[model samples]
Target: MNLKQEMSHSPQTVILHQHPLTVHTCHTVVVGSGAASLNAADTLHRMGQTDIALVTDGMNRGTSRNTGSDKQTYYKQSTSFTDADSPLKMARTLFNGGAMHGDIALVEAALSLKSFYNLVGIGVPFPHDTYGQYVGYQTDHDENSRASSVGPLTSRYMTEKLEAQVRRNGTSLFDRHLVIGIITTPGENGDPAATGLLTINMEAIDDTGYGLTLFNCRNIIYGTGGPASIYHRSVFPKSQAGATGIALEAGAKAHNLTEWQYGIASTKFRWNLSGTYQQVIPRYVSTNANGGDETEFLEDFFQEPTPLLDAIFLKGYQWPFDSRKLLENGSSLVDLLIYIETQVKGRRVFMDFRRNPRCADEQGTLNFDLLGETARQYLTNSQALLPTPIERLKKMNPLAIDLYRTHGIDLEQEYLEIDVCAQHQNGGLAGNHWWESNVKHFFPVGEASGTLGIYRPGGSALNATQVGSYRAAEYICHRYTQPPTTTDTFLAQAEHLVQHRLKLLKNLVVNPEQPSNVLAFQQELQRLMSRSGAFIRSRPALAETLHRFQDELARFPNQIHICHLKELPAVFRVYDMLIAQIACLSAMVAYDERQGDSRGSYLIDHEEGTHRISHQGMHFAFSLDRDFRDQVCETFVKLDPPADSPDTKQTTDAAVAAAKVTHQWVKVRPIPEYTTWFENVWADFRDQKIFDEKRG
Candidate 1:
């Protein structure tokens, strides 16, 4: 069958209510086909909306492998002393870890333990005990029964299961179709109502690459995933190419764009041990000059003295020093470290584990065992890391084992050599608890929406996707009143956008210098972000970084030419750089205003007393609009400060009296002026042409 004929005969077309070219229509159009998107589609179909289509840039080998192995294990679950360890406690931890930037309502929604269990019930195969209690495990920073893994492949497994469900629901899957932009029209309150989508059918050979196809719908969900691919090293698949950039280009305002997380480690290779090749692991922690562990810095700031000591305190054990008081200094310590590392060192300082000889051997053993077990399981069951067969991996990726033998690094090692790598961006399309962006009828979910704020807890990505998607569906299904069909203005606007995008795509293909510019800009942006914005924060570095970013913006359009339409990879790179710039500016401003010691990742240094301390009552500033102008601002509330006991207050009062110091207590100002910090970030982004070009 011909391409058009095949599409017409496809099951997806059979379920559609109108022809593909229809002007005014209502059909379900999912912008992504990832786990979240699939869930949205299933839910909509269950709600009786069968006129749907799932669009994506064809599945890659990574999609199935993305979910790690299904080996389930159990461990003791503990809570941080600050958290009561209840569901509410988990929610609070997520907020604090996120710098109190996530939506409280969404957090509350995600606290439902049943949500995780539901996935399990739907064939997720979560690890469980004989009595059926869910298995839990401990990770790097989590405190609480927060994580349960069905091996490393939990994400991939869940996605496949969701995809299966989507198919069963009769929802059309448009593989290899990319959503270029959202089709929006102004609503009653000047909000842009997302009525449909503008897409490119990449499958057709005759596809001019300029033909803009519109998929009309009352609601649009962006499950386009995170922007981690912009970084040099990332765990995400290459297919996750930051489609949110296109969304942002289409008038979506992303919040928390200035809080990109860095420091991640991915498996580099595997080794052979016990007649089996193991996955060789690399060292993956950030460190300082003295080689006194950087984690020690966090410990000192938190006043725990050590990780085990902190664990002990969390168990209600008391120590000689007040750990709570010590943690208050964490923020300052982080800032000081950043200043020293970036401004003084001139070279990237990392917690290098390559110096540890044990890294290679330990990692190798672990990799061999893991692969052997996985291979065994795959042979037993027809499934082996999704579509890739175990036999094929053994034949095709022999270097995975060869690299380990040649290098000392093995995957079994507990401590791997690690360095700070650029992580997830905290900012994306700005949204409320409902997942509704500034643009009406448009919903941003997962990493695409900066709803979770500065830092997300270990498993919060799953939580965010589930809750955000559910809430977005709820909002559109409940709150919206379908607009009249006679409104040709909405469809007309979509048509115009389609044409404009086509022209841009054409220019991209025809332009000669775009590819080189893209590569150059990408390198420049990565260097700038790494040098000034990576782990630590300081004013001088931040200012210089901003200047560099601005320079890039000035040189980008003129120097780069986008000739090959397929070479639009630079668009995402440019988008990520701009996003990173915003995040760095915001973080820098916050660090400048913050007076205390280091807490968590937001660190600054002070001369005396304990170096590490956690700051209480810190809040991040967010805007509903993407322009980040001063006009639209809101401060989300965070955890309350530690309360003083009656005895402590009385003792303080008595000490004051004993000193015989007659003093007037002046009203203290709220520290870390959020508004000023926000303005700095906004102005930095606004001053750049990148923002303007995107806005236009």
Candidate 2:
């Protein structure tokens, strides 16, 4: 299905604070252009809600469009004819991952096949067997073979297909608009309800005052993704800077903010070095900053070649860095070694695929017989037990090699630089089964929603995004079908907030005397977060970083200086990043203070911890918080003045000092046990009582 380029619509213009502002009014405003947001708009339009718009900072920029692995998997129900599966069983599998809400899991599991078929119907070429069965394979944290993929660019294809459908539907596409704030009004129950959005048009920044724009709509489907730019070492694409902070400031509670996935990823091309990349057992080499003094570092710790080679092969299956795998010289040891070499010793690490890993006792000979049972049998079955890693990779999956060439990285000629980089956040803004936040009318779908728990199946994120987007759109079209309030009413509700933002924009626009500090601020914040928040966490470091980030956020526009109007978007990105950092750091601090031990994808460095791993005079002591895994941590913050708490006075102290920041740990919700009686369910479905918030 080929389609022409989509253009942005001309919105009605209005003057605010002496600057011409564009006003776009729609029934539903989807605040991103990723696969999830596009699916939501497409589904909404198909369901008879024609007044839809998609607003994005960039139409072609996001993790879904730019990032993937060796074989990007999409998890769904078992589709093969011989496999036995049901929605209830899949729900139990998802719920078994501690701290996940059972109802959301059930919804995702029940809708998994529907969502998968939707992509299939839109021409995503998910491969199937000659017998007309969609074959599947097992992924991490999975008991069933429920994962499938279409090569290294599965997500890219999904995004393109969904986007073509949305463009053909004539949905309004507002590209290059940065969402700075979410406008809310008082609900009937006295809680804040989102009514609109405040955005900055990137193209008009030079001629207008910050390119200020307003989106007054009845509903907002926020799919802007997770906070990827907060980390200095991340596998997320360079363009994926998330707007989660603004949503948190708009009274959306965040869940499980501390749980994140980290893995060894190639730094040069920013791709996950999983699947066949590790299965071939590439040599782990380190060198000085100038690309000299090359050394194979893994041999320094391992006395033999068999165990080390097996660990490298297992790294393909166990890709994510799991703390539990550290005790037995497991695959996670590979990550720790890489971390020490790059971060502590200040050396560059690379994977030499051209040569197989060699040990002192091996005498430069490849030994296939010494491999472990799992690695040996897998390689033997795939006919990949060749002479070198490159030969094995080429024989097994040539598409993996081709993927690198497309990005200008020739694996056959050069080595690939790698780092233990942050990959995915298992948590984000809180939402119910319908993906609606506690703040009424606000929905956070895709990676922006805190749907996944501490641990999840590898490709479950893709499934969750489809299910959540469809569910949110269904709810919007049926239950929340009312049009937005009048433009005058929207302005009345959002005037003070708009005026305050304009004042800040005016101050930033006039500050040319000071040199531009956007890059400095961004680098500093990313470094602070990567140091204190990524994979390794310490109580003192988290607390101190929280204080520092809070101070930085409070001093936002005052300390930030921009020379040209074009720098406004970058300046605002720093502002949003700072807020996100403060919230994430605050959550880390609270988790540490609550006696939360290391669990999931991170390790809490404690001297008297229960577990310890040592190699070459480097010792790591971490406590496994097995009990903490059963509970979910929730965070709610107010960096700006709260509308509900009008009597609370603002102060000059850091945002944390003047704001209300709260964190609480609660028991996870158990899986719902529903009656399977047919007649009773049919009556409820006929009456439309299932859509009621109370029942959900």
Candidate 3:
């Protein structure tokens, strides 16, 4: 884990342990050692840009390397050549996800097949049918079975493969260097141009981590994962420290941050309870604090428990929490049922796989014969009409229970504690066709880039990361090229900025507080964000949360004091989490004011018409050739009056700071100059085969 001191990595990494190195520069620097970063470095090398290097907090620590489940998702166009599957169709469907850009969707679809094959080329073992065609299954928000996977550790497998490729290419890897700031200069067009990054060696060998460096580069590829820790309750591995907040602080415009994905996952083992796991019909139980009166909490929310339990069965496929489902009283209602049991009733809820629910019809036993048609048919077809959920799981994916067993949770005997947890952020640094953020020379790959829409197909993010990484490298090589120069002017400006940041960091140590309880503050931030901004949002609650965060931000100067060099990353992570939360709150404020309707994972309990408003539809010809230019439609966000409203916290700073949250471009996007855009930006990056070699 001490990647800095362990300078013995061959073929790739160059570590500086005892040396007081001040500055190192490269043509491009990929920050974060996830799959995206490895892929980006490799792509740049392929583009004949071998002067690329990667800096990361640590090796073997990232969302991509550490997180997995029963079957991780990999979304791409089926190479099996289905009758209805095409790049254009896939692009249309992906773009149709509200708040996403069409052009980006097209880019994802067009590059998907190549992106997928590229992974296979790098040694990722994706399952294929006997015909040699990749096998896939249907996932959330997709009518087609376009998702493929190689069990739970698909992403981890991908990171391993990519890291090998990166090593083979001998891309310089500087591990344990945490990037704390970016150096921006005035571009030719006067927009912010990111020229360098300010970083600190976290492992400073018993010092205060004073060893800092400014990585000046022609381009900066941000591959850090999403801010999963923004919520107190999250499905991400604790090591994932996303760079979205770093982007925000660097003045990059963020988009659709209010749009996120949340659903049920085991609290102990962080595995999503979807697919066959939900279809097996486990008993949903809630126990009181004293652990006595066990209750099937879903029965109270639904008129009859049968429909609710049936919905739970479908929760396997319908994983992402959707507001539309709740309005239609659909399967997503199961998410709401669980959310209420935990968030409202203040109890612990679990999915017991030992046995099926005690039937209301047969008094004490679940009659499998009387199960819902869908559940019955599925079990019948699988030949898994067993007495217990574990038996059905064994018939289905036995890895479901085995995965938890490895994590110290026996799903068969012990109850699987469940809750509505934050999974992924759909919106990110508002990126363009090439995954370039609004800031010039700064590109985002993986979850740091906002290429997804409100409702995306399950397992699509992995493909997005791959596609974005390749495209960003191509774009940097072609369109946004910068000369390698640490000229006096640029170096002077960068050095000034880095010194400022270092001074600020030093100030924290010089004026120490009562050795601040960093973990307690982090937990408080997560608790507030999950309660106020996760699955459901109330204007009053968000306003209150904003002011509360403002108060917390104001207290930063006095309360934040680092005692050890090892603690620097944790403190900065908490700081980034706050910045990310503020950005999310800002976006939700726009949603509440401009498009005041419940959409995607953003559920605002508005008193009917309390904040009703409309705006011109956001349109873009982002899809290649503007194929989806006509797909624009007026979208709305609405919530019927809640039965009973929660008490609103009153704060003077709430309304003021909430209104003042900076949004560079909330309701706009890059208008691609088609005639020039393709020739100017997409000429080299476009996949000719996707357009039948027509050079689209």
Candidate 4:
């Protein structure tokens, strides 16, 4: 068989699962095929609506099916009758994270109970005890033990269950179709309302590249997942190219574009190395570029002044990489050390759970008894104090090994290569409490909708997806019978958009310069993002990167030429990522430079230093350049209304499509109250007790 036939027959391909597209009109058009999209469509069907079609670039090409850690978590109402945890309380805790989320946290909390039940009805098997209690655990940043799981495939299970319901309900499915942009009509409320979608045919490879398909509908439900793949080292599934840029292009406000979550993950499969993976105390092994010189490196960095076991043990609760961990020679120092080892010292690092980490002396050797008092006490109490790291992992979560085994990494016998990687985005197509964007009828669901504040517990996103999707679905169902205000002018405007996009794609396909290959461009963008855009952000680098990207934006479609029809999508995805990075980096720099301190995942290193290092042929690069090191930091942040403030004017549909609307750095307000933080992390550890009640 030819390559096309071979790819078409692959399970990942959309051809085998292709559903006929006959009707162009529907009440709602749901973009994406992830759990969030399918759930939204399923909810629509249950609400007795039949005219809805779910579109995706390809079937099962999302984080829901492709990403997992030792275990995936889902949050909801407190299942323990002895504990008092209300949705309002959940909302308050969410609000405490930061103002980036606004009031959507409240909405998410209020609806999570019903959302959890909806998932149960759809067949997600969350663990429940014999007493009819849903036993829960404490995840990162959560003060309460509200999270539950069904092993590492919780999201995969959700996606499967949701997909099955979607199929059973006979919701229209359009596989291999990518929604390039959103179509909106001006509503009676003076806001732009979604009326249709602009899509690309991924199956048809022709001279003009992707075939365009425009679907007119009253509501547009966007659930394309997060911008996780925008960075060089990311835990996102390979195919998750989000539509946040298009949503922004269509005049949807993006919230908390600055806030993001970063952690260590395996580079090969892009799976997170968190929770039990850290609790198992894996050996931090490094190899030199020539591939011969090897060393267990963590001990060399943590010298005698810092407690090695304490730092390693802390990695369990503090899963996300934080700069503050560098203070007093803390655990986060492990991330900085690994970053330097890999990116600067020309070495590769791996997490070897096959053996417990080795130490400088006999007493320093990692053991269950050597762990910080809290970790040691808990393991001893739970009867999980195993000798080997893999054994400990099996005791804590056996599925962690099975997950890796399924991915060809036998945790019992092999090392899981890892690096500090981009895990999640706390920002996306900005939407409201009900998941509605600035544009009226456009609803951004799941991670695609930036409803989260600065920081959230590990599994809160799954809840956010369920809560946000269901809320958007509820709002959409209520408006099911309401007629869309589509007009001759709206159609004319929509046609203009199609012509504009076609013209752009034509220019992309028939380019003479071929200035840069999609891979090279993608690499450059990812490198730039990983450096100045992520974790250890630099103001000068961010400014320079933005200036560079703005130039490329001007030359877009002309700069990157597509030689093949299949390459067309990459060009657009790269474009989307570039634009998204521009917005993300800009917000990150703006917010970090002002805050001037570390909080949650938003950390900016203000240290003054310079060094010359080599890594994989790249020349010397500083985390903070001389210009920025000497520059003054903003002591106080000037307050302004939120990005979706009522005062902001709605851009015209023509203006939105014409690229007339720019991503302006709006004035940010002061920090709100009800913030959650711990002066002593160990206190939180003692109080929350890693979501276990051993002490109790």
TM-scores for candidates 1 onward, in order = 0.62, 0.95, 0.85, 0.83
lDDT of 1 at 660: 10
Q: Give the Cα lDDT of each candidate.
A: 0.46, 0.85, 0.72, 0.69
What pairs collide in candidate 2? none
Q: Which 10 residues in a row give candidate 3 its minimum summed lDDT?
A: 618-627
Error of 2 at 176 (Å): 1.1
User: Between the candidate structures 1 and 2, which one is better when assessed by lDDT?
Assistant: 2
**Model 3 regions more than 4 Å off:** 1-21, 205-209, 360-366, 480-482, 509-515, 609-660, 664-696
Q: Which of the numbered candidates is closest to the native, going by highest TM-score?
A: 2
Tens digits of per-residue lDDT for model 2, 472-587: 99999888988888888998887877876776666553456767878887998898898889887888889888888776666556676677888877877777777777778888
Clashes of 1: 81
Between prediction 1 and prediction 4, the one with superior lDDT is: 4
In model 4, the Cα lDDT at residue 304 comes to 54
Which 10 successive residues of model 1 have the least lDDT summed? 656-665
Which structure is stronger by TM-score: 3 or 4? 3
- Write model 1 residue lDDT over 1-696, tens digit each, in one string: 111111212222111112233232455466676666777777676665565566666654222324222121111223223334554445555555433432442344343464565577679887667766664644324566546765544667777887777766656666666566677777876866778776655544232433235566667888877664444433344445656555654567654444454432332421111111111112223355445544322233233323322222121111011112223341123333333343454323332222221212343222222233433353335332322212322442344433344446543332333223444555566675567777777888766765554445555556566667766665555555363233355556666665544434333324554334666657566666656555444456766776655444433333346555555534534644453354335445444443322333333333333433223332212111122111112212111222344565433222210001011111211112123366777786565422231221
By how many angstroms RMSD does model 3 differ from the true structure?
8.7
lDDT of 3 at 553: 56
Candidate ranking under TM-score, highest first, comes to 2, 3, 4, 1
| Candidate 4 per-residue C-alpha lDDT over 479-511 given as tens digits, one digit per residue, 9 for 90 to 100 | 446644443444554665566665566555444
